[model samples]
Target: MLLLPLHSHGQFQTPLGVAQGQLPQFRAAPPNTPANEPIGGWRILPRLNVVETFSDNVRLQPEALQRSDFVTQINPGLVVTGVGTRYSVNIDYTMNNLIYANLSNFNRIRHQLNAMGTAELIKDFFFVDGRAVMTQQNATLFGAQGVNNINVTGNRQNVNIYNISPYIRYRFQDIATTELRYTRNMVSSSSNALFNSQADAYQASLNSGTAFSTVQWGFNYSHQAVHYERTNRTVEFERSIGNLRYMVTPRFGLTATGGYERNTFLSIRGSPSSPTWTVGFIWEPSQRTSIAFNAGQRFYGDTYSAVATHRTRMTVWDLNYDENITTFNQQAGMSGGFNIGNSLAQLMAAQNPSMSPEAIQQSAQALLGLGLQGSFFDPNNFFSNRLFLQKRLQASVAMNGIRNTFILRGFDMRRKAFSPEGVDSGLIGAGNAALLNNTRQTGVNALWSYRLSQLTRANIDLTYTRFAFLAVDRVDNLGLARVSLVRQLPQLLPNMIGMLEVRHNMRQSNQPGLSYHENAVVGTLSMSF
Candidate 1:
C-alpha cells in the first residue's frame, strides 16, 4: 500500500475540541497534550491573500472567449484560541473578497466560521464538548476546472453547509464510560433548492475500560434522521455495535465485533435490519510502526478495514482502506479520515509560534493536496443522498528535510448504488445523483516546497484525476499544474509581515469542447499582529 501523509501546520477544532466519527472504525484516538502547558491564555492570528491573473480562457472551454484581466482577492482572517488544564476553545473566521477588474459582475464575497471547545463540567467525572462551522463549497463533484464546461454566467452552483455537534461523556472510574451526543447539519445551494437538506443525528455509547486483566470492551448505539426540504422525503437509520478485544501480548491483540443496522430508505430483500460481524488484529512492532486489519460480513456482502502508520525523524506515512455504506450528508463528517500528519504539524506550530504564515499555509495546502482529495473546492465531493456501498483505498506520504518538504498521495474509490432516487431527475441537483450512477474515481497528486533563502521559497503542484461512470459508459480525465515563488518582506513594516508571490497555473481536460489551457500570474501580501 502507498502511504500519503499530509503534514501541515494546523488543526480544526471540532465539537469538544476533539474529532468525531459515527463509527468506531472511522475514529482515531486523540493525542495527549503536555501537562506543563499554559493553563489559560489567548493568541490571535490575522492574515490576507491577494492574487491577480490573466486568462485566455476564463471559462475553461475550447470555445471560450479570449479574455485578459486582473483578479484581486482580499482575504482577511482571525483565529482566537485558549487552552487550559480542563478546558480548551478555538474560534476562527475568515472573509474573502474576490474582485474582477474587467468582469465586475463576477465579483463575490465568501465567509467562513468555525468554533469548538471542550469543558470539564466536573472534575474527571462529567464533560461537555461541541463544534460548529459554516462554510461554502462547490456544488458539482468537479469544480469549474472539471471536464464539464465552466458556468461563466456567474450562475455557478455553490453549496453552503452549517453543522453543529455537542456531546457529553461520563466515566465511572475504571469500570465503564458513557456518552450522549447530538448533531444538526443543514445544507443549501445557490442554483437549485432541491439540494437543500437537514440532518439530525443522535448517538449513545458505553464502553468498559478493562473487564479483566488485558481485556477491553465497548458498545455503541446510534440513530440519524435526515429530511430533504424540497423533496419532502425523510430517511432514518438505526445502528448498534458490541465489540471486545483481548490482548495476547503487550503489542498484539485480537478483536471481535458484532453489529446490526437498519435504514428506512434502504431495504435488502424487503428487510432493512442487517447483522454484521468482524474479526481483526492490532499489532505494534515498534514506536515507529502500528498496524490494524479486519475482515467482516456486512449488508452488501463482505467488508474489510485496514490501517498502517509509520514515522521517522523526517518522514511520516499512513495507509488506510475501508468498505462501508453511507449517505451524502454523512460523508461531510468524514472528508479526509483522521489526518494524523496534520495534527502533528499543528502541534509543532503551536509549540513554536515563530513560523511564518506563508510556510504554514504552504504546509496546509500541501497536506490537503497530498490527501488525493477528489474535489478541488468541495472536500466531500463524492456525495449522494441515496443509500450506496463504497470502497476506498488511500495512501499519504510526507517528508521534510533541512530546506525542503515533499508530499505525494494517491487514492481510488468505487461506489455502487443499492437503492434508487426518491425524486425525478430534473428535481435533483448537481452531485445529488452521483450515488445512483455507479462511479469510480482515482487520482494522484504531488507537491514540493523548497526554501530558496530565509525570506524566499519556491513551490510546485501537479495533479491528475480520472472519473469513470460505469452505468453511463463514460470517462473523464483532468490534469493541473502550478508553480510559484514567494519572498517575504519583514523589514518594511513593524508588527506586520508582507510577502510577494508570483504563480502560474494551467489546467486541461480530455473531454472535447471542455478542454482549454490558460496561464495566470498573481501577487499576494499578508500581515499579522
Candidate 2:
C-alpha cells in the first residue's frame, strides 16, 4: 500500500510530491489549506487533538480477568511541506500522550514520525533521497494483539527506520545509459526481542537507450552488507544479472534474465548461493490495463511473480503475487509503510481522469480528514529477525461514486525460515525460533464510506484475519467491526473537526487462554492553526 514512485529503471525513487497514505490513526487529518499558506515557499500547520475512550477490556484479556477503563489522549502534531525547483520535502510528526483513568501507572508518551524528501544536487546527474519512519509494531505473533496504543497488551514496540541514498547517472550519447548508487540503511527497535541492524548497499546498472528499438538489453550488479548489533554478525548479499527484452509488437514484449547470487547465511536446505534464471512477458492491451508475469528458479526452489492492474472510469483493480527471500529489516526499509491516502488518490484519479494532480491531492486529503479510510491488516509482514522465504498474493478493488466509496482487499501470505534458529545461530534465540519456522496468514478487509452532506460523512469498516502456525499446531482468528461519523465544524471553526466511533473486537484461538472480546467507544475533537 505504500506509494512508491517508480523510476525509468523500474526502481523506487523518493517522491517529490506529498507523502501519501501516512496519516496517523484514530485522529483527524491535516487541516484545510489556508489562504495564507505556503509563505516563503513553505507551508506549516500546527494542530492539537483531544480524545476520550471507554473500553470493556482495556488489556484485551480473557473475560475472567478483563477490566474496564476510561482512556484520555492529548496529542499535538505538526505538518510541513515545501517544494522548490531543485528539491521537495514533506514531514509529519505527532506526540501522543495517553492517560489511563484507573491505570495511572500505565500513562506514557509515544512519538510517531513519517518524513521523506528528495533533492537534485546536480541538475541532471546527481540526486539524493532521505526518509525516516517511527512507528509501533507487534513484537511477536504468538501473543495478544492490540488494535492501538491504548491497549495494555504489552505486545507492541516502537520501531525506527532510516535510509539515505545518493546516486549519479550519465548517458553515452544515444547508445546507452548508466547509473551508480549507494545507500545506507538503519533499523532499530525499543524491544530487546528484535535486533538492531545497519546496512550498506552499492549498485550499478547499464541499459540500452533509444538506439535499440526491437531488442533492449541491460546489466546490473549489487552488493549489500548488513550488520546485526544483537548478534554482532554481518551478512552479505551479492548479485549480478543480465537481461534482454524482445518486443514482438507495440503492446507485447518477452523478457528473460540470467543472474548469479551469493549470500553469507546459514542455510538448512542447500547452499546459500545459486544461479538464477527467469522468463516472463509483459502485455499492455490498452492504456487502462497492464499485466506482467515471471517464473524463475533460485537456490531454495522455484519462484514466481505476477502483477496485473486495470482501471475504469469509476473503479480500480490490482492483483499481485511475489516470492522472495529476505529478512524483516530489509522489508521494512525497502517498502517504507502503507499509506491509505496514496491509495485513495489513485482511485480518485482513475475516477476523474481530468483532475489535476494538485486538485486530486487536496481531495484525497479532505477524504482522509473525514475518516473515510481505516487501517487494514498487512499479512505480508510481521515481527521477525531471521531470514525467511516469503510468498504472498494480494488483491484489491476500489470504486468511487458520486457520494460513496468502497474498498475491499484480501491477502494470503506464507513464510518459512531457511536460516538456523538459535541465539548464536540466527538473529533470535531458540525459545521463540519456532514461531517463524513455518506460518500462514490470510486476511480480508472491507470499507464503505458515504457522504451524507458536504460537511458530514459516515464510514463502516470490517476486517478478519487468520494466523496459523504450521510448526506449532496453533491457530488464531481475529475480527473487528467499526462504524464512525465525522463532521467538519465550520460553524465552530473552519479548521475544526469532530468524530464519534464505535467498534467491536474479538479473537478466537484454538489455544487456551487466548480468546477474548471487547467493545469500545471513542470521541475526538481536533483543531488546526
Clashing residue pair totals per candidate (backbone < 3 A)? 10, 3
Model 2, runs deviating above 4 Å: 1-37, 337-343, 350-376, 424-431
Worst 10 residues of 1 by lDDT: 15-24
Q: Which stretch of 10 consecutive residues in model 2 shows the poorest summed lDDT?
A: 5-14
Whole-model alpha-carbon lDDT for candidate 1: 0.58
- Model-by-model lDDT, in order? 0.58, 0.75
- Candidate 1 residue-wise lDDT, 1-529, digit = tens: 0001111111211111111111001121122323212234544454444444455455554545546656666666666667678888877666756677777787787665666777876776566666656554444443444211122433244445666666777878779889888878776655453356788989999998544548888999999888876676788888899998898998999999999987787543345568989999999999879999999887667789999988776677888898777766566543247454563354334433554332343345443432122243222343355666778887878766656667777788887766665442554544445534677778777777776665555667777767676766456666666666655454763222232333223434444454455555545455433
lDDT tens digits by residue: candidate 2, 37-138: 565567665667777889999999999999999999887777677778988887877787889999999999988787899999999899999999887766
**Which of the numbered candidates is closest to the native, going by highest TM-score?**
2
**Model 1 residue 311 distance off true place after TM-score fit, in angstroms:** 0.5
The Cα error of candidate 1 at residue 58, in Å, is: 2.2
